[model samples]
Target: MESCDAALPYTLIGLVLRQPSPPHRGAASCPSRFLRDYASRATNTLLWICLISVTSLLCRRLARLVRLWVQGSRIPGPPSNPFLGRSKLIPGCGSLGSLTGYLAELHEKYGPIVRLWLSPTQLLVSVKDTMLIKEVLIKAEDKLPLTGRAFHLAFGRSSLFVSSFEKVQKRRESLAEYMNGRISVRANIIPSEIVECVMGRVDTIMAKGTLDCGLVSQQLAFYILGSTLFGDAFLDWPKASIYEKLLITISKDGCFWASYTIPPFWSREYWKYKHMCKRLKHLTEDIIQHCVEKYDLLSKIGHSSYKDNKDIEDEARFNDSILLDNMPSGVLLQEEMAEYLTSKEELCGNILGLMFHGCLATSSLISSILTRLALHPELQQKLYAEIIAVQEKTCKLDSDDVQKMNLLMATVYESARLLPAGPLLQRCSLEHDIYLCSGVNVPAGAIMVVPLQLVQMDSYIWGKDAGRFNPLRFLSEATDHIGTHKKYEDFEKTAFLSEPKRKAAFLPFGYGTRACIGEKFATLGISTLIASLLQNYEIKLQPGSENDPKPIMSDCLLQQLLSSPEVVFTKRSKRKTWKSKGSS
Candidate 1:
């Protein structure tokens, strides 16, 4: 027989206990039976609660697993950490703080279209396929490409570099009318004056015997820009020192990445960047004020009504008379300022945008080309020979003279291909989803990156020698049974000379309607300075320097040599003259 005492409560203070067993000899009263039923009911309810909780937890986990599987199936990418994504998987990416090498590795591992996660929320897709690049940059570029938050912070929302597509389009339309005329006029006349400025610096370098070509190139770049844009005022200003300070503040350690990712407000670098932006804003305002005054002076002189003149001769005379002492004609800067002059803040923003984009980008290009020339002494000699041949015929190295030097033009194009100032072109799918020829789909809010370095250096498109610097690839041979004709033109238009297959491969300035408006001006300025330097001196690498003779590229928004290289400049004496055998 079972024991009835087992069912009895330990304490029966308020009521009697009851047992649920057949009547026994010493059985408790009916109260015992009731107590046993109450305890049994309570126990069953507690067990049911636990069972439901465990079943709910298991179901939720299974749903999460299914979600991850679905998301992972849509695109191909390297293995990523669950939380960190692929942020740390890239080698030298964190320490070096560059995506160039990292992107190259990804392309090799996962084909042309590769997806990467900067963080859990930020997804990046990079493309190296040429046709896809065209589709993103040209065909589907309805929205302005997104510049990361770091750029937005550094440059205001109104800046063309970071502005929305609609706003940029409006600004571009207004600015184009002025820039096209100004660039055409400036390109023709500024080359000779720029040559003079470069030669002046070369004189100092020759006397010193050895100098930092990197620094010299930067100085030349600024001087050319200042003279053309600011006129006599830039000479008086501390342009070199100011430009250095701007670069230091803009590219300060941890600032760019921090501003974009998780801005460390408590950190010293962020505060410094904020302070720098303030200082730069004031400086830009002052520059604009000077430009306005210069414009007023031109108007007083009855030269303010000058329109875009297509006649080269007529424009040359006007440019010669007005553009004195390396002062800009002030037409473009003045007009842009007048439009925004009502608001000082807007004016300052526009001017700073022009200064940074125009000066910094061009300077990097100039410095890279100089470093390349210093390393290759034989190339310098060949370029010098070309310059001398042109000088012998023209008596003066002017715009027309420099334009005829095919080898010189080729060298510039090749250097640009090897080391583009802007390595990665960033865009965002703001308006609608963008689908590529490769069948990779980029959602509306996702960031799209075009790896120019990877595309331009691809062996499949550019041949095996693409990795090597050979300007001759641009020069095609027209061979007959008995003779050959060498072809050359302005580097900006040299794309036509390239084989039909490789026309889209070279885009140092950029592409599409929204491409750089100052391309002609910059190309003219760089070519002019280079020709003058080659005409005067033979440049070679210094014997002992910490930096390598060959430049090591670094990415800091723009691609520049990691360190400035030291170079020796030897002045050239009178040499035998040579006649051009064929037209370039």
Candidate 2:
């Protein structure tokens, strides 16, 4: 039976192998059957792949949700929609003017610490509480330093403004040596000359008797910053008109916001911004190249002169010539900085970054002060008296002189407080979660906004007259009980300058290690310009313009854009007499 079974299996295999010759039915039928089988297999394989992909995606999302739940629930916030979050509900959410008002309303309704969602994936926690602000800005700053992908896109990743904390610290240390007290003293000598030149040009424009102070201040700021940073190189690079166009285009909110928030392919504004960036990059490169060539030529001349066996007197003269022939002190420092930093590209990025920052912020500050001064002639008189007193004490007006004018300093501080250069400071926690004093635990990758505008303008903190423009509020003594005293009825009297006991409550130039390095520079420049203007000109609102000079808060690329009313500049006889007195 076993032998029979083996023989049968062999016989069947032989038959199957040999039987293929008899299966030639219709050729078309065979091919159709084969195609059907192949299609069925392919369809099954595709279905399995799709099922696996869907399963993986769902698992990932589920895991993420589980992780969030395990971490802890978020803080109290306004009710949000599923996809849009609170963004759709906030009026003018994307527009700066409307955004400012909306944020104020949010704070009013939600208390000091408020939670908000920008989108389904993005969370924001805003804290105006002084204690919590201190904890966020000062205590755990290293762990939760300022970070913005948008800023990184606008300014290069290597830019000090967008760099990592460690990198920023290194750059700050390097820059401090050049921008410190001694350098400031040297820089103080030039503003007077620069301001004088700018005023001369401004006088011609104001000859028509009706002036746009906004335009005038912008021009003055550009020239001052240009000369200060680039020295004489700016004069040869491009006309003020070209620069104005470039700056206006570059500084527009549409340019930066679009680039920061939207994809270039999807956003027309972003594409335009990219083109502008390219143009700016080219312009800056040309400037840098010119500087390099000039430096090299001077270096060669210096070396050759030394090698020519010149006498000691000639050598000393050559040395002096080289120093005098060098680029502007600011530019020279940046050139030296190029060696210490990564590359020239980084230096250019930083230089342009500072240019944008100094030009816009300084001009806005000057405009704000001028508008305030014009609105209140009495205050203008007071500021002028202070400037006069300082000039009288010292034969010349310098940074030190500006510093001593208490009321002038107070006025500057007040303007900055009310309409800060940067109204909102955006920060993010990248490394770990942050726990606020209110016990609100913000998750990692969440944005934390320090509502500087709201915090500075809080009625509870600054009293009921917080909305009023009163410079005396900053200079008042903490012990002064003017808030309760009815007798102190005058605007200045009611507003006392209370020294800020809580540091976090006031941050015009930010606070801690990451504070604006150009604070002192900006302060010196603004103070010098204001002091000079007050000394030489009486700024008044144009006869036909608005009677009250209110700050028109416009949408800006970066922060609150302050524009002053149209005003006329009338040269003061008092200042002319003082100048003669100093000359005599």
Pairs that collide in candidate 2 are: 473-497, 474-497, 475-497, 476-496, 476-497, 476-498
Q: How close is candidate 1 to the true structure, as a TM-score?
A: 0.71
Model 1, 1-584: lDDT tens digits are 55555545544543343434577765656456757776777788888998989989988765644444444336677777435745475656632246867888778888877777666545667878776777777644443332335545665545354435654675576565555555545544455455556567666776867687666776677667666655545554545468546744564432354445566788786687778877777776566456546545654444434434335434433443322212233343335434444555654556555665676667777777777787666677777767876777764445556667776776777777877767676666565667666776676545677777777777776676667666656654311111212222322333322332256767676666556777766776678778767766677777886544444545555445436777777777956432222212
* lDDT of model 1, residue 72: 38
| Top-TM-score structure, candidate number | 2
**Cα TM-score per model:** 0.71, 0.74
Put down candidate 2 lDDT per residue, 358-437, tens digits, no spaces: 77777777777888888888888877877776776666556666667666777787787877776566666565677776
Candidate 2 ranges with C-alpha deviation above 4 Å: 1-73, 85-88, 91-110, 139-157, 232-241, 253-272, 289-342, 476-503, 549-560, 574-584
Worst 10 residues of 2 by lDDT: 1-10
Q: What is the lDDT of residue 210 in candidate 1?
A: 67
